[model samples]
Target: MIGSLFSRRRPPPMTLPDPAIVVPGITATYLRDDYPLPPEVIWRVLPFQKHFGSACLHPDDLRYEAREPALIRPGPLYEVAYKELIDELRYDLSPSPEAEVPVYPFAYDWRKPLDMIEADLDAFIDEVIERTVLTRHYYKDGYDCRRTVTLIGHSMGGLIIAGFLQATGGLRTRRRRTCPDHRVSKVISLASPFRGSFEAVVKMTTGTADLGLGASSSREREAARLTPALYHLLPSFDEGLEVPAPLPRTLFDPQVWQPSILRSIETFVARTSPITRTVRKRTEALFAGLLDQARTHRERLDAFRLDQAGLGPRDWLAVVGCGADTRTRLTIAALEDGPSFVLTSDDRRNTWPNGTDTGDGTVPFLGAEPSFLDRANLVCVTPDDYGYWELEDKALTRFGGGFHGILPNMNMLHRLIVRFVTGAPDPHQKTWGRPAPGVRPDAWDPPIPGLRNKAL
Candidate 1:
C-alpha cells in the first residue's frame, strides 16, 4: 500500500518534444542604439510610443556588408507580442513544469531583408541543434548528432523559415546557400504570408504599420520606404488585386507605385542623406532599389519547389487565421499622377477591410497558403478556433484586424503546435478547422497521417 502510494505520487511522464526555435514577426524585436555610452533603447515596446526617427535605416543599410545607421542593433523579442506564446511553449511542451524544454526565441532586426534574416536563422538553427544535443537525453547515448529541431515562425518569421528550408532543400535559387542544419524536420508557421499581404502596402503608404507599437509619424513613413522587409511583403497573389495595375500588373514594377510613394522617399532623402544628385533622381533610385531587391527575393521564393526530392510540402504546418475582416484585396487605379491605391475604405478607415472570412486581418488566405498546397492540404483556423475554457486567452488576444499579430497566442494554435512537434495524436479537434475553397468537409484529413495536422 505504501509502495502504491509512492508510485501514485510520481506519475509516468510523457516524452519531451523536439527542441524548438520561435522566430517573431517584424517590429517584434527591440532595436537599441549602442553608439552612445548608455546605449539608448530606441525601438522597444513602451519606449517606441514616442516615435524614434533615428531607427530609420539609410538605403546603404540594405547593402550586404553594411553596419547600422548609427550603431543601432536588434535586441530581445517584444514581450506582449511573444511572451505568452513563449511561456506556454516552454512549460506545456515539457513533461513537467520542472523539466526544461528548449524553446529558443530568435530575435532579428525586422527592418532588414528577409534573405539576411534567413541566413542568420541558418546559423541559429545550427547553434540550437548543438545546444539541444548537449542537454541530457534519456533515450540517447553520448550525443544525438542527428537530433532534429522544430521551427515555429510567426508572421514574417515564417517567411524566413520558408526561405531557409528552400535554401537547404533540393531546389536551389538566388539568396540560396548551404544550410548545414538538415535536422529541421518540422516547421510551424503562424499567420505567415507566403505570397504576401496588402497590409505591407498600407505600411508603405502610411508610416503607421501598427505591430503593437503605436508609433506613427512623418518619420515612421520615411522609415517604411527604406524598410526592405515591408517591400518583400508586398502582395503578389492572384486574388490580392481588386483593380489591377496599368501594364505589368505587379507591384515589382515601380510604375505601379503611387506618386506619393516616390515623393515620400524624396522628402526623406533630402532630409536625411547626402543627395549627391537631384532629389527626384535619388528618390527614384532608392524606390527602385527596394522593389528590385524585393522582386529578387520573391522570385527566389516562387522558384522554391516545395515538392523537391527530399523536401515535401507536408513537412511544414501552415496555420492561417480567417473570419476576420481583412484587406484581402486592393484597388490600384492608374492615373496621370501615377498609381493611387484604393485600399480598405476610400475614406481611409486606415485601410482595414470589412470583407468576408478571407483572411486574418493582415494575411489573405489565397496568399498565406503554400504555392504548392491546395484546399486538401492547407489547414485554415480562425480567431474563435479555441475551446470554451480558452475564452479568457481569446479575450486577451484582441481578434478583429490585429488577428495577424495576436494569432500565435491562440490556445488552439498552441495545442496544434505541440501536437505536431511532439508527434502527439490530434485528440478529435472540436474547434474552427475549415477546409479550403475546393476541399470537401469529409476530405480534410485522416486519410494521410503526415499531411493531416502536420503541415504549414
Candidate 2:
C-alpha cells in the first residue's frame, strides 16, 4: 500500500500544456470614415491606408479562428460644441474628440452624446457578444473567460479603452451584454495617439486647406489656432486682408500681391518662429515622460479594487509601439477644394519632421504611453522581446527589419499572439533572458538600435 501511494502523482512542469492559445474569438475595432470614398469599395475597404494595410498583414498569423470588426465614429461637431458654449470643459471633457475635429474618426450613430468613451466601449462589447459565443476550454475546466476574448485597437482605439475604463464603472464591470462568463481578457494598442501631439496641435492651428474639414468645427480649434506652432499655416484662410480697389467699390481682387500681403507673410513668419521652438522643446520632454510612465504604470494599477472584474495578478496585459524614421514625406493625394490631410507613419518617433529627434510620424512616445488618469495596468514591450517578428534568416534579425505589421504578417506575430493570449509557454521568451553587462542604451556596435530590443 505504501509503495503504490506515491506513484507518479503529477506530470512534469515542462509537459503541462498552456491554455491561452486554445481560446477563440477576437475583435479589432476601426474608426473614422466620414470622408467620401468610391461607393464600390465603401464597406469593402477603409480610407486610411495604415488601417487597411495592418489588417491585411495579419492574414497568415492571427490565432483565433474568427475575427470581427467594430467601427465607431466620433461625435458630431455641433453636439461637442455645446460644452464650449457653457465652458464646462473639465479634465474629462477637455480631452474630448471635438477639440480636434479634423483628425477625429467618423461615427455611425450620432443621436446620443459621445462624451464618455466608456459608453462607446459598451457598444463595442455589445458587438463582440453579438458576434461570439461563450464556451468552456474543456469539460473539467472551470468556466472562466481568461483567454476567450481580446480587444485590439490602434490610435483612438487606445483613447476609447481609457475612456471605457475610467468612465462611470471600470472596463471589467461595464458590461452591456454580460455572458455570465465571457468578458474582455486582453487589450493591445499599437502606435496609438494617447497624449496630445505637437504635430496634431500644429496642424490644427494652421488654417490651411490642408487641414481636414472634420476639425473645422472642433472645440479646440480656436485654442489650437492661437498656438504658435500652427499660426504659420493660417494665412491660407485670409480673405480680403489687402484691398487695393480704391476704398471698397463693391469688391477688390484680393489675389493681387499688395504691400499688406507682404507684411502679413512677414509678420506670420516672425510670430511663428518662437512657437516652432516651443513645440520642439515640449515634444522632446513629452517623449521622455512617456518612457518613464511606461516603467511605472504597473505600480499605480495595484491600487484599484477590481477583484470582481475577474482580473488578477496572473492575468496578462501588454502594450506595443513601433519606431521608425520620423521625417517621412507628407502630402494630400487628391481632394476637391478642402485641405489635404497628412499621410505618414502613425508612430511619434517616425512622424517628427526632419531634424527632430524622434517620433512614429504622427504619435510620440509620451503621448503613446497611457495617460496619468489611466488606472495603469499596461505592460510596455519593445517589438523584439514581445516576439513580434522573426526573420527567415538569422542574419537579418533586426529590430526595425521587423517593422510595424511585419510581426503579425510573417506568422511570427500570429504565433506570439496565440502563445501569450492563450496561456501557452512562449518559445521566444527564453531568448530574451535579460540585458548583458555594459550594454549601453545608445551603444553603436554591429546591430542597430531598432533591432536591439529583440536581441535582448
Q: Which candidate is the best by TM-score?
A: 1
Point out where model 2 deviates above 4 Å: 1-117, 130-148, 168-182, 202-316, 327-357, 371-411, 428-455
Residues 1-456 of candidate 1: C-alpha lDDT, one tens digit per residue: 532322233222326576789999888888877887887777766434333466677654454212343677778987766787888888878887555788999988888888888888888877776676556551242224234577898888888887877766622222212222355667788888888887788787876643434535676677777888889888887655755533577888888888887887777677666545677787787788889988888777777765542445567777766666666667888677677888555322212122333777677776687674555666776656655554454433542127677777677677667766666665475223455545666577521254333222
TM-score for candidate 2, residues paired by index:
0.39
Residue pairs in collision within model 1: 316-455, 316-456, 317-455, 317-456, 318-455, 318-456
lDDT of 2 at 210: 22
Local distance difference test scores for all models: 0.67, 0.30
**Cα error, candidate 1, residue 360 (Å):** 0.6
Question: RMSD per prediction, one decimal?
Answer: 7.8, 19.4
- Candidate 2 has an lDDT of 0.30
Across 1-456, the per-residue lDDT of candidate 2 in tens digits comes to: 421322213222221122211110011112234433421111211121222211211111121101123222432222221122112211111223322101122232211112233465566564443332222222112222221334444434444443444343234353322123435555444444344233442344342122122223332332232222122111211121222333221111122212322233333334433344444344333323322332232222223333434444334233333344432222322234332334344422342222223334333344454433222333323334343334343322221222332222223334333344444454444322111213333441211112223433
lDDT of candidate 1 vs native?
A: 0.67
Model 1 lDDT at residue 389: 54
